[model samples]
Target: MIKIKIISSKETYSVRQPVLRAGKPIESCLFDGDDLETTKHFGLYFDENLVGVVSVFENKSNNFHDEYQMQIRGMAVLEEYQKKGLGNFLINQTEEYAKFQNASLLWFNARETAVAFYEKLNYTIIGSAFEIQNIGIHYVMYKHL
Candidate 1:
């Protein structure tokens, strides 16, 4: 059976290794110096092996809506673990974490290929596609919680 849980110190290694192996350089998006000290992250495990993970961060903007929106980053599911609902589990955990932080909306820079996946979860694209260095086309997707 699959289980979802908050990321703990002991479980960090399991999650990080898979993310790095996914070839996405999750660390750059995850750490962000200050955020490493403040943001919350979660992972999904299948019988003690971490198979998926997601990270939540407060929007680093002074804009009025910043308080109401939380940014999701570094979401990944291992190759062998895809299409098994683990992504849904991690997304659910991220949303719950955002709600706990009193955020009303969840947002992310989702890769073009993953846009449909987020859309299925009720996330709507807000604007045109943009590119991040080394990262392919992406769109800003948001979901109201």
Candidate 2:
């Protein structure tokens, strides 16, 4: 069985390590030294072991802009935990939280390999693919809340 929860500071390190291992040199902004200043992090647990993690953050805009959107970042499922629907669960939870925050949309720079996965979750790509060192090809995908 699996459980998902909002993580507090004390557990942030534990929750973040797996994502770091998964992304390696491309550690997402969520793993940055000042992550807490910009993102809300969450974790997925399998029988008491941390198995996946994701970061959610508000989109930056011009001082006068009032648009509201949330981006999902640093999403990863441990190698042993992949292909079991945990990724979908994490995305669902993230979207639910985005809605709770009154976000109009959910967006992410999804890895190319993950395009179909996000597509299955109903996220649509808005442009051409791009590359991020150590992170493979990526596309800007979004879904309305």
Candidate 1's C-alpha runs over 4 A off are 8-30, 33-35, 60-66
Model 1 clashing residue pairs (backbone): none
For candidate 2, lDDT tens digit of each residue in 31-64? 4432566567788999989888887888742321
Candidate 2: where are CA atoms >4 Å away? 8-34, 60-66
lDDT of 1 by residue, 1-145 (tens): 7887777433444565564334555454344632455577677889878888777777743322655778887788877888877899889888877888789888888899898899899999887899987667888888878
Which of the numbered candidates is closest to the native, going by highest lDDT?
2
lDDT of 1 at 92: 84
lDDT of 1 at 124: 91
lDDT of each: 0.74, 0.75
